[model samples]
Target: MASITSSGLGSGLNVNDIISQLMEIESQPLTKLQDKAKEAQAKISAIGTLQGALSTFQGRVLSLSSASAYKSLKGSLADTTIGTVSTAVNAQAGSYSLAVTQLAQAHKLKSQSFSSVNAPVGTGSMTIQFGTYDDKGTSGNAADDTFEVNGDKGALTIEIDSTNNTLTGLRDAINAKKAGVTATIVNDGSGYRLLLSSSDSGKANSLKITTDDADGNDTDTAGLSRFSYDPLGTKNLTQTQAAQNAEFQLDGIAISKSSNTVTDVLQGVTLTLQKVSARDTNNAPVATSLNISRDTSGVKTAVEDFVKSYNEFVKSVEGLSFYNKDDNSAGLLNGDYVIRSMQSSIRSTLNQGLGSGSYYQSLGAVGVSFDDKGNMTLDSTKLQKALDTRPEDVASLFAVNGVTSDARVSYVSSTAATQVGSFGVSISSPATRGNFSGLAVANGPITIAEGDNDMLMVAVDGASSGQIKLSPGSYATPAALAAEIQSKINGDSRLKDANAAVTVSYNATSGKFEMSSNKYGAKSNVQITATGSATEATLGFKVAQGGTGSDVVGTINGEPAKGDGQVLTGSGKAEGLKLTITGDTAGEYGTIGFSRGFASKLDQTVTSMLSDNGLLRSRIDGLNRDLKNIGAQGNTVTRRLEDIEKRYRAQFTALDVQIATMNSTSTYLSQQLSMLNNLASGNKK
Candidate 1:
């Protein structure tokens, strides 16, 4: 047995006990800190919850405010304008308009036909497929074949009553023929009849007849029942140039053209001629001469027609609700008014000095408005007064882009006019500092609408992030511009590219941006902006603009972005922006864009706040390792203390027992010795 030593203890405290006490102190503090952190997190989360709710609410209300139905249209017509519009409005500021003053009409080809291709021997039935067939105008039974008629060569049983052929019937039959020719007959009762005619003028609308006589006769001679069979073919009228004329008056000044489709005649209106096919309720041809010729009466009729059309357009526009003010949805004439306004105003005359813009305020002055029915209406009397009193002012009210209407609808004025063809431009990226256009942007040749609102979205970079830019441009013909897009972009490397670092591509159909990454790096981003036809400084249009910086969303911070910056379909890309441009009398140049791409640059922002090598996770890992070390040291010390305590306790118990045994032995020995001494003493006594 061994005795334990107190020397191992200091100040009466065991090393094991002291180590345990230190661990308890450290653990309690850590627990308190954790609880405090969790409480603070809860508070922060509450603030975020409230903010998110308010953001959603505000966004919803603002969206309601911007709906198109809430706005009204107002503007006046002028000599500087075209079409029948007394006035137009700014409802569809960024959209396109197409006023078909004169549309290309299909020509009419009329004729008479036979039942069989080979009208053999007059015993066959007669058929008249009017209007057109197989390139020739005449179809059905021939006039000489319909009735018995004698020709120099032969005779047939069928012949057309040449004297009784009605132009109305002939016209219908010709139209049915679909032969591509127009046919009609004219009569004034001078003993003349069967005046066969075609729908088209010139040789394109010619009449051809086939004839065969019964009994193997070469000429059908029996078809002259209603016709005066003339061997010389005197009744066959040649289809020369149709006398149908295009004529109309502007401000009481008469204008005329031989073609039904007249261009650049009025400032902005194109006139088309359509012969009246149906008579009045009387079911008869207009007693008036088949006057295809342009005359003062024709001019008056054109004016009256224009007035009626203009009024009708107004009525329709006012009737359609785009937004319901009360319900905050669509209204009476809500969505439809804008479209109506666009179509009607596309070719309307603009003001003369509308270039000044301040005086050419709106369409209300010339008399355009959404009547109670939500339909568009025009004030003829007011329009006439404006035209009569301030002809120049009226001109200023309707026609502003140029001296003529064609100049505004088209952009091919001078070489200096913003060349409306394929244009290319690239914007620099703000995030990557590397040129992204070289890698990602697609080669471009995008189509531009003749009017505004058609936006072109341009991207800055495609790698980590990209910017979106909205631009509105125009082209004379989408196809021609598309063909020249890549060439233009390649030719003008400066305008089309950024430091020769970006490739370009434009989807004429989609009109969007495509970017690719060529550079290598970490930090990448893009900035977006919008431009419109009205915004071009050269257009001279009374242009107002917005949405240049409203783009708040960006993506692809450290990931792939495939032109994700897309516009919502119904939400029209440029719908949020407003544009008012004074068109260029010299010409209007539409807007276009270029896409620039950039590669990723090294991005260390995540670890920048802390040590480059130690992020929050690393620090947490380090703490865990330290905790393990502390635990290991504490555990080792604990095990050693336990062994020492056990050994000492055993030693102390044995020592105590041995000491007691020694005392007992000493007591017993002393007793025995005392007895022996007593005995000896007794013996000696």
Candidate 2:
């Protein structure tokens, strides 16, 4: 509620305007404070912008520092129509003559045509087995040894019952099981038939289905045995496609695989067979030339990215810190010692060359240069030529990866050791993961009656702990119950703290419950104990084989080292260094070298600069502090201005009231004197 008081009306002067002008003068300090606050805010924002640019630059540096960026490999096929190929980073540059003979295929079987898809096959049970068969008419079961149940891998079985007696129902049931076979209904011209095919494309994954009728008769027409398929016995289902392995000749050496995609056939190379090599005029298989070579374009792009990122960073820094001579003004970060020091440090690091003993030791040699304005440029032609002629030298310019010179030895990771030196690796014993199997039962699954609950406790590497509850059910025919046990142990919340899990499997061949830990090392083991109403002895949870895993025994730089599973860590001379050993190269010894190339050094420097205690973060923090102080100062000045304005308004209002009272008094005096004068004139008249 503001009072309507015209202060200047009585005094014949604009006192309100006069007070406004005086208050403006009094607020000069406040204006200055606001200006300073604006400057502080701009400085803080500028630092944020600079930080973002530096982060981008750091990311680019990290990209170039990675080993895969330099070790990338590309595969080329002479005949593109024949097949496509890809190579891993460790693949060597070479050419190989390949002749793909045949493509691998999954085993496809079709049942005899029926009147309708909804026709019932009968009530009973059908057992599907996966294994390879021969021409001897004597079938053998080998897939049972390798089938996996739940997290446990072993032989598998799928049961068909009266609930899924129809062809369509059976198809759906089989698909739900996710077993090694896929079932579909094929409608031929005559009628509809159920087609079953192996999911995997390997000879060892052939399918054989046997059925037992409800009447206990093998010749029941309406029973599920009508759909039985046995290569040596019943033949209700005929093989439309044979289960065979993909065979090929690489460099005149014969090779075969169960799948069209051949990975292990070549070191670090995967070949997907599209079709058999086309025949030549002479009817001989055409040889396709496969070449594996270093990918220079990838490395070149990485360098270009680094250059782009570096220039952007430089622009940001200059924009924030430069002094403008034309305007005689300083940038947001002008005269900041920390920023200047950072610039100097970055330039110095770049100037220091790497690869002292190599032919190409610096960025300049690899065709990366900085101009007078401090912007980096790339000479693509020169860089490509260097990569083409001396690729190893070019790679060393960025990072020198420790090459596994020995054919038998493989390199893993290196830490705690010098990143630019060489060390010797000698392995005595390769690491092995622990595996334990329970006592083998007979041919069928061991059943538990209703209310017969069993609790299995587990420990892995003395780290993880978990308990699995086995429910009562008939497990002999279908093997899905074993999967439930695996889920309980693996999905337990309490066991997550151990950082390990135990896989449960039912070995169909051995008829035993197998449990293995998820880790590899001498201390890694899965100890099982049946508690509550169930005992280990009765449940046959006794370990039949495999209790403890073996740690990798190796030496680094001739100093004794400790091995945890597949990792080898060095001590003394190789202190702070560790390496991972993969593959089955036990007892293999080799020298591993490490080098932090130009990119790696730059990456480390930039990372430090962006760290919490780095120059950039510290500067940003200081600017934030300045901004906060400026806000505080602004608040103080504003409070003072408010007080001054209030005092001026009060004084001006008082003056207006006094001047108005004087005018009223003078008016009254004049009026009274005028009246007296009028009376005197009237009397004289």
Candidate 3:
């Protein structure tokens, strides 16, 4: 019988267990690599957390980097029912008595009653003009009214064909144009009628519609002529409400405005008229008190928010790099240089002084400071004192600010490239506007005939005005003629669309009519390109070119700067500094002192730390590279461990087999010897 024995049983040793123990010992390096990779991943996640906190803190810092935030103004009224008031940054603190006598109203007109909304109203074309109507000499009759077209509003022409001959079609067509007038149909129990109203609430926005009926009779109350509302001729539409100005009393002075919302009367103050003031026993308008004052609550809130956000950020940093001495544990980024550097940079910026020649130079001057624990604290009382006494200085201490000595040389803007220092401003030549000087008139009152001296073409600021038509009337003086020309030129649709306008003035000394562009630059110019047949005879204006405008020549910090319109941009060390020169004199204006404040500096630092190639990104990229290397090494060690385990298994199996073979041989020999001994003993017996 053949004896079958397992290799481990014959050797009296467990081969599987021995091989497992050896393999475990050999993979120590790979295990250490895996632990290192996990640490790297944890550190990367910690950095991401730090970046998120920094970003949240940066948003609060940016709020204090502009001067407008600190220039808030508040308005209050003793009687809120009278009207509402709003104020701008430039508004002065004062008290005023206001009395609203009238509210501006838009003009409304209605056509004669019709049978239905779809009633037929034959059509050809209709032209709508916006203007002011003068009823000074007329009683209540509409035929004696005088209308003067508003130069600021251009006349709009609309075509009416058979497709839109009905009242509803005409209403829809007029609405589609958005031509400063709204049309609707109304039923007054007797019949339906077409109602039209001006889009704006001002005396100068009244509508005057004229039509050319397809039936060849335009003034008759038939066809499209029924909608005509020319004050001089047809009067088919009846005026229900006339456009009027708003009348009010400010500090005992009577004031009138074209709109109910008055802005220009008060400096930086806007008043919206709601209702007429209550009348007293004597039929006089009652007065309401309006008070304007500086608002400081917004600045205080901004400072508080900044301090809270900054303290929270500091706490986050400390927590990320914390170390537990008692427990013998460490945070993921226990000794990170990048995190430490970021905190240090921000702290240094906050501590730096702003050399802006302001009363307040640093955050400490406005009662913001850091404690021993690196947490920011705000002194509310002290901050309020500074804001109340030196508000502009406090604003300059937290924003990128510029101060000019001359009021005419105002600081427009500056860029990051602009250096923080005083720069000398010297203007060699001031800006000039382009102008056209027409020939002098022969005698007095110029007569503008229809179709004779009415049409002309003009170009303003290099933008052409196509076929501008002048209103036919009699001018008493050169000033009146100048006003008429200015009105006609500015009312051109082509020039208005291009944002180009002109101011026509009568030069009494030169005895000439001058038309100048409203813009001031090298491209600012006005030219009369074409004229009517009698234009030269009546208006004394022939086809002529105006003088070209010249740009402003100046130097900033002794370096030649670029000029466009009224803006002058500096170069060299003063690069990106924009200044507006409004003075006509050509000489040294003054120096502009500039500085970058704490909030601006700190914002820049945090922005740099969080950019794509910033500190956190670089560190994360390096840790990722280390993780990849560790993974590669782990793969290599795993391959080597597989070979080592195979070799160990093979050697142990061979030793077991050899031991089994030896044991079997010894047993066989012993058995043979025993048999021989037994036989010899039997022979001996």
Highest lDDT model number: 3
Q: List the residue pairs that clash in candidate 3.
A: none
For model 3, give the 10-residue run with minimal summed lDDT: 1-10
Q: Give lDDT tens digits, candidate 1, residues 1-685.
A: 2343443232233534544565555456445545544543443343234233323332332322221211222222222223222112222222122222222233222223323222221232122211111222255534322211101111011232332234344334434544333344434343223344433332222233333222343333344222222222323223332323334433334444434545454323333434422345865332221111111222223233433544553444334434557878752324333243343333232221222322334455756444564444566666555544434333333322111122112111121111111221111121122222211222333334434533223333332111111112333333323222222222222322442122333344454332322222232222223334532322211212111111112111121112211211011221112111223222222332111100000011112212334232343444456556555666666666666566655554455556656666788999999999999999998
TM-score pick, better of 2 and 3? 3
User: Looking at candidate 1, what is the lDDT of residue 585?
Assistant: 24
- Per-residue C-alpha lDDT of model 3 across residues 1-685, encoded as one tens digit per residue: 3443454866889878888888889989998999999999999999999999999999999998887777778887788988799998778788999998999999899999999988998989877778777886648676566666665565666678989999999899888767588999999999999999998888888888888799999889999999999766668999999899999999999998888888998788999898999999999999999898889999999999999999999888888888989997877788888877887788788777666345477788888988888789999999999887767667778877777788789788889898877789999998888877888775467778879998889888889988876666676666766666776677566887898998877788787888889899898988889999999777667887576787788999899999997889999988999999998879998988777877888889888888888888899999999999999999999999999987987787778778878998999999999999999999999
The runs of at least 3 residues in candidate 2 whose Cα sits more than 4 Å from the true structure, single-residue gaps closed, are 1-5, 123-132, 136-154, 212-214, 217-222, 341-345, 348-362, 385-421, 433-520, 523-547, 555-562, 569-578, 582-588, 595-624, 649-685
Per-residue error (Å), model 3, residue 157:
2.9
Collision count of model 2? 10
Would you estimate the TM-scores of all the predictions?
Answer: 0.20, 0.73, 0.92
lDDT of 3: 0.84
Root-mean-square deviation of candidate 1 = 27.6
- lDDT tens digits by residue: candidate 2, 513-604: 67787788887776764344543443557422447888888887788889888787878656656677775656647776555677777877
Better of 1 and 2 by TM-score: 2
Candidate 1 stretches with Cα past 4 Å from truth are 1-27, 61-70, 73-685
